[model samples]
Target: MHMKAIQFDSPFNIKIKEYKTPTIGKYSLLVKVAYCGICGTDIHIYEGKVPFVTYPIIPGHEFSGTIKAVGSKVTRFSIGEKVAINPNFSCKDYGYDHHEYCYYCKKNRPHFCINWEAIGVTMNGGFSEFIVCPNTSAFKVPKEVSLKEAALMEPIACCLHGLQQIRIRPENTVLVIGAGPIGLMMVSLIEAFYKSKIIVSEPHPSRRNLAIQFGADIAIDPNNEVLKDVIKKETNNYGVDVSIEAVGGTTTAIEAIDCLNRGGKALLFGVSMPEDTINLNLFELYSKELSLFGSFTNPHENDQALEILKNKLINVSELVSHIFPIWKLEEGLKLMKNKAKDVKKILIQIEDNPKEYSEV
Candidate 1:
């Protein structure tokens, strides 16, 4: 059987070609893809900015689908089950001939695996009609969760992982830099669970308003209003307890660090350029005892993300502003790359009849 897929042959060169449907191994599952969310990392891959990506690869890491076939050894999941994929893979999953696990993987941190490989980043991904992934990498979707919502599980898991690193308390005041989809997810998570005062810094007017709607107590336009000044005013000059940098830029990262109180914790969850650098004040670090953390990818938080979606704790539906067919993926990519005002979460619909699994 043949399937249509979008392949990135090189930077700025994407093609929609018909390829043979992939067969699964004993530990894998063949899934008919439903929806795939375009991420900022996808843009990096498209622009050839990601150093680890190879040419002629299908680029989609956030996706959900229904299983069409399960390998004989895949007893945990059955055929026809709805599932969301965790794209991160360890050396063993990549068929590496290593007797001992990598240091990071051995410590249960596969996101930093020395020989890490991701489904869409390092291998073929869900920008196609079908995808074959290991059963261990797939998590079943709940009855109430739509495949569209499930497609965002990977990113939501990433946000959850970032939050877990900082351990925000209910009494803490939180500031999230950037009102992008990932930033909004962080706001939603903080709002739903922490009950902390949430502030968002975004330059775009529309995104700032959207952040307010997503439970941000104060949405400041960083282009006009000073973030540190607003942080001081909001916290009565104590600064925020937690700051999350979701916009992958050095400027925003510095803002995240500068707007924190003494003993404050900052989570740098953004994906910055490889060569990006920041100038930090060692005196401030020593005086305030600030803690800065870098979050790579979702380690093992997919299930928690799914549960949040299942209970409708976060407004995932509102985050989806546009949907494009697989053929129009490049168009969607361009819109997202340009930071179009209307773009929030751009979903690429792979199946012609995704509604068929609406009840799944």
Candidate 2:
């Protein structure tokens, strides 16, 4: 069967093209894509900034879909079920020759697999009307979760992994240094899971206001206001216990380090360019006993992300500021790539209504 899909031929080249939709294998399920989210990585791919991405790929790693058909041997998932996708490619798939080859996968950290290739970046992904993937990549979407919010599962899972790395304690002060979707997710996750005082530093006034509305205790305009002064005043000059650099810039990384207290943890959650580098004070890092962690991708955090969405613990719906149909994929990507715009999450709706296409 042929289906309409958005294909990225090369840098700055994207178009809606008709491609053959694969039939499900014994271990695979055919999914009718509901929504695919535009992420920073997608923007990077469009700008030719990401190094590992190959050309002529479908660029959508964060997505939600419904089971349209199931293979004969697929027992875990049934038709009519809604699901979220995990795009990380591991060595546990068909043939499975590299069982002991990768140290990270052997240690139960497939997110750091040696030969990892993602669905959207390196392989055919979910920016289409239909997708057939291994049942392992599909997680059952919770009943209370909306299809639109389910599209955000992959990113939420990534942010959850970042949260695990820094280990925010109750009553601790956290400074999140961006107000984009991922940064705002950090604020909301900290508010819901950490239950701590949160401060946000965003240059955009609209985003700073959003940070406050999304549960930040204080929001500072870094361009116009002194972020260091605000943090000192809020923490009584002690500094924050945890600092998350979500802007993926050298200046924000430096700011995050400067605002951290002694023995504080820093979680670098943003995707930086290959040429980007930040100068850090090695003496201070050693003297203060600071810990630094880098979050690469989503681990086994999709289920928890779905649970949070199902229970309404995090307001992901509020982060969704715009939606576009599949035909308007390029327009959505352009809007998401615009830094001046107050856009959070931009979703490409492949189908009008999931229920109409589902067997249920």
Candidate 3:
């Protein structure tokens, strides 16, 4: 059997090609992909900006699908079950290719494993008709969650991990820098779980309004209004208790640190370039006793992400502004690259006739 897939032959070169369908190992599952989200990492790989990515790779980590076949040893999941995949893989989990566990993996931090590999980033991903992944990497979707929404589980998990890093309090005042899809997801999660007084900084007018709609108490246009000034005014000069930087820029990262109160915590959830650097004031750090955190991939938060989606705690549907077929993925990527105000989360529909699943 053959399956169609989109492959990135090299930087700035992508094509749709047919290849023999992949089979599963004893601990694997063959999944018929439903929807795959195009993420920032995908863009980096496409432009040859990600140093770890190799050529001729299929790029898509945020996806959900139905299982068509399960390996004999995969008793946890059955055929026809809907599942979302966690792309991060430890050396051992990648087919046990390496017996020696990395330090981070042994410490229960596979996201930081020295030999870490991801399904889409370091291997073939879901920009195809079908995928074969370890059963351990797949999580079953709840009855209340649609495959479309389930496709967003990966990002949701990432956002959840970011929030966990900050340890947000319900009464804390929080500022989210950027109103991109990831930023908005942070906003929604903070509102739903922490009930924090949420403030958003976004230059785009539409996204600013969207932030407000997503429970932001104040949405400031960073291009016009000063973020620190606005934050000062909002918090009566105390600054926010927590600040999340989701824009993946040095300016926004500095803003996240600068707009914090004494003993404030900041989570740098953005994916910056390898060469990006920031200038920090050591005096401010010493005086305020501030804490800064860098969040990587989702380690073990996929189940919580699924629960959040199943309960409709976060509005994933509103975040999805456009859906493109697999063949039109490049067009979607171009739109995202142009920073279209109307484009939020873009999903690549893999199945020609996707089943009409009920939404939560």
Candidate 4:
């Protein structure tokens, strides 16, 4: 069988091409994709930032689908089971050093998997109608969670894992720099987990407004007059208890550091560009005993992300402001790259809704 998938052949060159069905490895299973969420990494690659993106490589990682087939050696899943996927598949077969990074695999801290190889980056992913993955990589979606919502597992896992790196108390004041999708997710996650007031700092008015909708008590534009004064007032002049930098810009990174309260924690959750560093006051980092969290990709937090969606703990639905059909793949990429108006959760439709296409 032939599968049509979106792939990058080179810089500024994406194509919807056909490829032969991938053979199921001894531990792998085949899946029929239901939804593939367009992520920020996909846009980064489009802008020529990634290094290992060989020409003609499939790029989707956040997705949910149904099992269609399983390898003869596989027993954990059967055909027809609906599921969402955890994109990170580790090479335990490679070495024990990988376990140091495995938060759960090492000390039963399942939220932090130290040694993991992501599906889309290490191999082709679900930007197609069908793809094959190990049972270990595919997870069962709950009855209450829609496939569209389950498609956010990868990113949700990311924020959840980052949150695990630092413990936030109910009385703590939190701030997030950048109101992009990740920043917005951080806001929702923190609000859902803590009783403290939440604030967001974003330059874009549209995004700042959206932050308010997503649970940020205060959304400030850095360009706004009295921005610093407002942030200081919000924290009662002690600064925020914790600040997360979700936009990977030097300016925003510095802002997060500056906005923290004494002994505050600043988590760098964004994928910063190479060679970009923010100037900081070493004296403050020492006198205040600031903690820095450097987060990179999802580890072992996919399940909590799913639970948040399953229980409707966070108002994630409002974040889905854009959706597109499969044939309009380029349009979706363009929408994200241009940072179009009121854009969040750029979902790529894989199958025609049977209700719309008419059931056979």
Candidate 5:
């Protein structure tokens, strides 16, 4: 059977085409993709900025869908069940093609695998009517969870991992730089889980308002306001306990490091370019006893993301500001690239059925 798919043919080029649907193999599930979220990496790929991305790729890693068919060996999932994709692909299976685990994988850090092949980055991904992924990458979506919201599980898991990088407590004053979708997710998750005093710094007014609505205790316009003053006043000059850089820029990263307590932890959660560079003060970093770390893709946290979504502990639905059909994916990409003030998360809807058992 033929199905519609969006492909990034080359840099500055994208087109929708009818492609042959993939058949499921043993231990694989044929998923009819319901929704896929347009992420910053997708924008980077479209602009030919993602260093690892190749041309002629179906780029969508954050997605959810229903099982259309299951291979004979796929016993964990059944047909018509909802599932979310875990795009992190481990390329270091010991017995596969005589493969040996890389240093990172050997250290149990597959997120930093030397030969990582993420679904959207290296392999054909979910910007299509159907996809075939191994059962290990599929996490069952609860009946009460909408597939549209379930599509965001990947990002939620990533943010969850980021949160784990820092030791957040109720007394900690947390600051998140940038109020984009990921930053907003950080705010919501921190609010729900840590109950920390949250502050968000965003230049855009709409995003600042959104941060407040999503449980930010304070939202400051970084471009127009003195962010350090706000942080000092909020924390009684102790600075924040933790700072997260989500804007993926050197300035925000510097700001994140600057606005921290003496022994605070900093989580750099943004996706920066290969050429980007940031200058740091090694003396202060040492004198203040600061800890800084980088967070990569989600690692074995999809089930927790599903639990968070299913329990409705965080308001992820509010993060989705726009939804476009699969045919208009190009327009959606443009909206994401332009960073429209109101556009928090842009979703490309392939199939809209939310019921547990239903035909599209």
Candidate 6:
């Protein structure tokens, strides 16, 4: 089988290549990809911000697919069922491969592997028709969620991990900075998990507007409206109890911290570039007792993401704004470059099935 893949050689240099089908190995299954979501990290890799990408590595982790061939020992999924894959790859046995005794993975937190080989970064991913991943990485999709929409599961799991980091009490006021895909996902997850007064800050007109549709109680553009004033007024002069910074920029990180009330928590969910440094008011930190930290990726949150979809707590379909074929990966990336106008989830169409099964 010939499959399409977007190969990145240098910064902003991605060209599609047709590759032959990979031979399946023991304990590895080949899946015909159905959809792969272009995440912010994908764009970062395209811009050469992410490290450890060998030349011509395919960049796509948020994906769903149907099982094509299962390895001899695999008994998990069948050929005809739809599935979502959590592309975080780790080698638990290899001492150098992964720091198994690390703070997170010591207690079986495999998602937070110290030496993680992220599917898209270290290995080829779902930018093609077929993907060969471990059987345990695949999650069965619900009958109601489309395969395209199921691609959002990876990001959803990530957002769920971010949420799990901080305690979202129902009494607290939460502010989500930057209403991009992750910010909007924060809005969606918070809606399902917490009933706090949720607000979103985004300068983009279209995304700020879509924030409301994604369960943001209020959407405030920092350019036009004062975020501090909005939060103060909404929370009766007290700032938000918790603030989530989803945009990997110094400015947005500062905004999230500034909006946080005394003793409030600021969760940095976005992975800023290594060179980027965020400024903090030490006085605010000392006097206000502000809590600031970063949430890297999912930690056993994939199961929660799958369960949420199965339960219909969050409607992933509403967020899927555009769809394109795998051959149009460049076009999709271009659309992502202008993502503010084309806001929300964009999925790559691979194989649409008539009936979604357990092992698709």
| Number of backbone collisions per candidate | 0, 0, 0, 8, 0, 4
Cα RMSD of all models vs. native, in order, equals 2.8, 3.3, 2.6, 3.6, 3.5, 4.1
Per-residue error at 115 for model 1, in Å? 2.6
**TM-score per candidate, chains pooled:** 0.95, 0.94, 0.95, 0.91, 0.94, 0.91
Clashing pairs in 5: none
**lDDT score at residue 237, model 3, on the 0-100 scale:** 95
lDDT of 2 by residue, 1-360 (tens): 799888989988998899988888888889999999889998898888889888888888899989999988888899999999998977664425655547887788888887788888888888888988888788999889888899999999999999998889988999999999889988999899878999999988888988998999888988888898889999899889999999888889888999988998988888888898888899999998889889988878999999999999988888888777776667767876665567777787887733222110
Per-residue CA lDDT of model 1 for 1-360, tens digit only, reads 999999999999999999999999998999999999999999999999998899989999999999999998878999889999999988656554556878887787888898778988999998999999988789999999999999999999999998999999999999999998899889989999998999999888888888999899999988898889989988899999999999999999999999999999999998999999999999999999999999988988999999999999989998888878887889889988887885688899897834321211
Model 5, 275: alpha-carbon shift in Å?
1.0
How accurate locally is residue 133 in candidate 5, as Cα lDDT from 0 to 100?
89
Q: For model 5, how does the per-residue alpha-carbon lDDT over 143-173 read when each residue is reduced to its tens digit?
A: 8899988999999999988888787999899
lDDT of 4 by residue, 192-271 (tens): 88856888888788998888887889888888645558888877788888888887888778878888878899998888
lDDT of 3 at 248: 91
- For model 5, what is the alpha-carbon lDDT of residue 291? 97
Model 2: how far residue 138 lies from native, Å: 0.8
TM-score of 6: 0.91
Error of 5 at 63 (Å): 0.5
Give candidate 5 misplaced runs (Cα > 4 Å).
91-103, 352-360
lDDT of 3 by residue, 196-283 (tens): 8999999889888899988999999898988899999999999999999998999999999999999999999889999999999999
Candidate 1 TM-score, true structure as reference:
0.95
Pairs clashing within candidate 6: 66-360, 81-359, 81-360, 82-360
State in Å the error of residue 103, model 2.
2.3
lDDT of all predictions, in order shown?
0.91, 0.86, 0.90, 0.78, 0.87, 0.79
